[model samples]
Target: MYLWIITGVVLIVSFIFNKDKTIQGLKKAWKQLYGIGSLLVLVLICVAIALNFINEDLITQTLSGGNRYIGFLSAVVIGSIAMMPGFIAFPLAGILRQNNVPFMVVSAFTTTLMMVGILTFPFEKKYLGFKVALIRNFICFTICIVVALVTGLIYREIF
Candidate 1:
């Protein structure tokens, strides 16, 4: 892919200029990757299993029915409740889309998955204060809905 080529070029250039720094950076990156890799694999495995149990028709009916609004709202609620990093959320979004979920619902789900933190609210409130945490979550939730609507319009999912 283009991104891989670009990254390889940049990495080679970095190594040519400063091998030590490049090696250090790679080590740090590897450490982070190693830490997250296991969790990522587990999550993917769980998703695969869940997908087998879930009916694609049900998802299409519930999440792809843009005009209903129920599907959109359901996605938002599910997204808000679930917490995961962007790396994980993206692949999940792709799976959802492949399963016939519309762009609107996938965007809403991924946006809220990354932005809204209902499960982490207590920790956020402790560090950021209840008011700030509450406001941030509210704003993020509203923004995700707008994003979903715009995506729906773009995809002609909403009539």
Candidate 2:
């Protein structure tokens, strides 16, 4: 709320100072937003559908129960596949923690959710080329696991 207020005030000030530039900037911003809007909506819808099938109990059982490695692997796979915005992912992480899901699993999910983009691979590939996109995704996936393990260690969720 505060951020929005601040942004609105800043935008108003910019408009006052240079109406033409402000209008031009806003037009470009809108174009970019419009370009990505459909894809963003599609991604959010996919995440919503996925969430409908996943309950808090299932998350706790799969992520915090026996076989930590397997649980971590499951989180990596699911998170890598599901591409959601950070705004949604962070709150979801909180919910997972509230459900008693271990920090390691939550980290794995959130890290991979932010880093890996399996669902957006084609879009990335189009701009970055197939090889670069694939390599980036692979590195991000590895880093997310490392980050999750480090977080687990810090939180003493792992011995």
Candidate 3:
């Protein structure tokens, strides 16, 4: 993916140079990319802070004894409803794993966290078109379920 992205950048730069708009195009791309990077960093920081305040042991105890299927369902439901930052999710997942939460459940939850932002629905609809947003969310949710099932089967087979 990184190789493809770099190749795409090189191609775009060459095209811009050929068109004699290299400097302007580069500037525009840089600004847009930098803004996105900044936003991602900010989100990460917020997530980290939230995770730091939560009780890791308590979360682990809560999730560790649950059935794998139940955990997966809970993750999907919570991910859809909860609007917590990704940083918190990561640490929470780590704690859950330590206490024996199924890998499939964690994977599904993480996927849903980024893919199905219930809290952002209105904003997404306004900015990206309702149909587009709905379709994307549906696809993401379906894929998360499929992935969880496959991962659960694989884990069962391996261990």
Candidate 4:
């Protein structure tokens, strides 16, 4: 609601200054949206299916969710390997936590989901050779573990 209102105000202001430029900008934005609409739809569908099919209780029961180290490691592996957009991934992490999953596990999952990109390795490799891509992802994965551990420990202590 606020976004629409703010966007309306911006569009009105832009049109007042220069209608043609504003129109052209809107057209470009629309074109870009159209291009990614299909990809967005597919990603959302996959996310929904994954969340529904993968039982939260099973993960909690099997992955030693009560054991911080095991949960952390499991989170790191799952998050690193899963190919999810940040927009969707964060919400999923929250859902896991709400389902009584451990804080450390959710933290690790969220951290690696943002920092490491196992699925995007091909794209990264195309830009920066395979070696660099491999190294970068490895380093990022390690750093994510550290960050998640610290965040989880502090969060657990405070709350």
Candidate 5:
């Protein structure tokens, strides 16, 4: 890929100019990668477990044709809690959509999937204080529901 090529060139240039610094940088990067990689693995494992437990039938049965408010609330809560990467979440969302999941539900889930992170609350609270973090997440959560509902309505009216 282009990015791989670019990274290789940059790394070669770095090695040419300063081997020691480049080695130190690589070591630091490796440590960071190790930590992040472990976290990613854990997240993926949890996602897989959840996906196995929550099948298409379950989603269709629960999230479909129910009270819109209930569907929206369920989507928001599930989205806020799921901490998978967008790469994983997007495809999972597509599967939900294909299984006749409401676009509104998908929108809410995907939006909050990116915006809210219950798992990351501790980190947010530590840096931003609990009140600010809570307020921000609450606002984002409200926006996700509004956006999903509006989008669903528009889609229905237009098409």
Candidate 6:
């Protein structure tokens, strides 16, 4: 609601200032919107299917009985290896939570999924400098570990 109102205000302002430029910009945006929307829809469908295929029961059982350290380790290892989309990762985390997976582990896993993309390392190194990519990943990995530990401690204290 707020966004629409703001957009309307912008459009009105733009029209008052420069109708021709605004019209041209809108035309270009419309041309690109369809392709972008279709790509997003395709990705969403793929992620939904992947989430459905993951074994919720197994995820729950494994997490419910695991030690804190083990869970943290698993998060790091799994996060490093798992190459799923964010949409799929969140659903997997939800399943793990329902199964009694520790909050710290889930936090770590989620962090690693977003922060440490080992699967994209080659492309990252090629586009950005290898050293820059490695350093960034190392920092992110360290932060994930710290976040997991801090979150685990906080949860332990609270509950």
Which candidate should be chosen as best, given lDDT against the real structure? 2
Candidate 2 Cα errors over 4 Å, as ranges: 82-106, 119-131, 149-159
What tens digits encode model 2's per-residue C-alpha lDDT throughout 1-159? Answer: 999999899999999999999999999999988877877777677667876766445555677666777888888887887766677778877877776777898889888978998877766775689999999999999999899999999999898
- Candidate 6 at 140: error in angstroms? 0.6
Across 36-59, the per-residue lDDT of candidate 6 in tens digits comes to: 665556656655665464345544
Q: Backbone collision count in every prediction?
A: 0, 0, 0, 0, 0, 0
Angstrom error at residue 158, model 4: 18
What lDDT would candidate 1 get against the real structure?
0.77
Question: Quick one: best TM-score, which candidate?
Answer: 2
lDDT of 3 by residue, 66-134 (tens): 577667777787666445667877988887777778888777777787788765665557557899999
What overall lDDT goes with each candidate model?
0.77, 0.81, 0.71, 0.73, 0.78, 0.74
> What's the lDDT of the predicted structure labeled candidate 2?
0.81
Candidate 1 vs 4: which has more lDDT: 1
Per-residue lDDT, model 2, residue 66, is 67
Per-residue lDDT of 121 in model 1 = 74
How does model 6 fare in lDDT?
Answer: 0.74
lDDT of 4: 0.73
Off by over 4 Å in 4: 62-67, 81-106, 114-139, 149-159
- Decreasing TM-score order of the candidates: 2, 5, 4, 6, 3, 1
A best-first ranking of the candidates according to their lDDT comes to 2, 5, 1, 6, 4, 3
